[model samples]
Target: MARNKFQTLTEQMFYILLALQSPCCGVDCMERVRQMTQGRITLGPGTLYTLLASFEEAGLIAQTALEGRRRIYAMTPAGREMLQGEYARLKAMTADYAAYYREEEKQ
Candidate 1:
């Protein structure tokens, strides 16, 4: 079967949406992702802006304001739903890993 668009999020995509949970501009969004991941993830301007545009186009995020050349964005209800789905998928993967490893250790 053909897969749906965004059925699974890339690491960059996931962090970008997570940062947009609150209204913020592109620069702030990059910083937020960096801080949240403890510098493990850093988004360059090119990747960040491109994903922001895509998300806005998909109706997953909405641009809340424009300040000079800066545009602020926040997650829409659709974005939240997407985020929740990804979170659940990730949680389930971890649970499966734990269960498999536990069984391996028992054997």
Candidate 2:
């Protein structure tokens, strides 16, 4: 089977999708991402808009509405599934790290 290009998402992509759990415009999405990460992740307009365009192109997100020039976006069903898969992957990685360290501690 061919691997999905987006099988793994960059941290920016992950958070951008996460912020779109509800419909929001580009600026709002950027703010939400920063707030969600407690300012740990700050996305500039260039990066955020670029990823949004890419996500929309990939069918991972949809533009739900437009307020003037701003476009409100929401995650599509495909986007949610992709996000869940990424979450599982992250969990598995953490589990592997823990398992490895646990055996080391036992030795």
lDDT of each: 0.91, 0.91
TM-score per candidate: 0.95, 0.95
Q: How much RMSD separates candidate 1 from the native structure?
A: 2.3
- Tell me the tens digit of each residue's lDDT in model 2 across 1-107: 11276879999999999999999999999899989999999999999888988899898999999999999999999999999999999999999999999999999
Off by over 4 Å in 2: 1-3
Off by over 4 Å in 1: 1-3
lDDT of 2: 0.91
lDDT digits (tens) for residues 32-87 of candidate 1: 99999999998999999889888888888999999999999999999999999999
Q: What number of clashing residue pairs does each candidate have, in the order they appear? A: 0, 0
